[model samples]
Target: MDSGDILASLGVNGAAAAAHALSLPAEAYGNDAQLEVLWAMKAYNHAEVYFNLISSVEPTFLKLTKSDDMIYSKFREDFPDMDIKTLDPELLKSADAKEKWRPFCNQFEGIVEDFNYGTLLRLDCQKDYTEENTIFATRIQFFAIEIARNREGYNDVVHSARAKAKQQQDQC
Candidate 1:
């Protein structure tokens, strides 16, 4: 979930050596207030950066993908019978999209990966992609809904906040 595990996985010997050199005396991590604070801060920072990055990238992807109708139509065309709640999440998550879902995968191309996929909350739970619900989904799913909002003009809710910040900066 974090860089430490990634470093360890990529090269155990190097990671071990680095940790040995940089780390303090061996000590087991305790489930204490300090540990909790560290985790909370890390999670919040990561999420804030990630959400903003996604928000900023929305325009570029919208330009690339074209119309909102095209995005949704492509979605429907790919999975005419999508009932994710009924299906097995593990099975669906690992199913190869390269061959079967080529169109969708092609849209994202090299940028997306299985690891980036995780649970996301949609704020407006009334509709499917209303930014009001959280569900476990792939990177493509995030793109689909976000692109849907971008093209359909629903993202002004997010954009307006940015505009306000810019306005404040300009005034200052």
Candidate 2:
């Protein structure tokens, strides 16, 4: 796919918007086609790893970053009303959420790698990654939502459901 298609598929409207989402210069995008491909690859790899992780084991036992406790506490404090098990992309992408998330994201600058970099976030905890079910979010935002999902038992439910489905398939 061309860059425009790729950007659209990733939920980015344009190079300018994609750059803004990633907190990078707009010029940094169109000038390097290879860079965009690399970014797509990285996103796909991350999605694959996370899908496998949640499917294979209990996500609550998984630690996303070294500062899991601190991050989880802050996430809960900042988003007390967030229904992590049924996370809505519209709510997360809203102006209010963005305004609140900036500071929360900035606080983990050094603790998380590429903390502000754009990443693909699954909108629903019970579903695997899919174009319609994904949205672009900062890495820290992904961590916060996912950490909440894991801790709240949504991901464990996903794991159990997938396992049961696989067992049924084997029996069939």
**Model 1: residue 99 alpha-carbon error in angstroms:** 20
* Whole-model lDDT per candidate: 0.49, 0.80
Error of 1 at 155 (Å): 1.1
Displacement of the residue 162 alpha carbon in candidate 2, Å: 2.5
The C-alpha TM-scores of every prediction are: 0.40, 0.78
Tell me how many clashing residue pairs each candidate has. Answer: 12, 0
**Root-mean-square deviation of every model:** 10.6, 6.9
Q: How well is each residue in 34-149 modelled by candidate 2, as lDDT tens digits?
A: 56665775677687888898888888799989988888999999888888776777667789878888899999988888888777888777787898888888888888889888
Query: How many clashes show up in model 2?
Result: 0
The residue-by-residue lDDT of candidate 1 on 2-37, one tens digit each, is: 655655564878656544533333245544674443
Whole-model alpha-carbon lDDT for candidate 2: 0.80
Single out the weakest 10-residue window by summed lDDT for candidate 1: 125-134
lDDT for model 1 comes to: 0.49
- Indicate which candidate wins on lDDT: 2
Q: What lDDT score is found at residue 127 in candidate 2?
A: 81
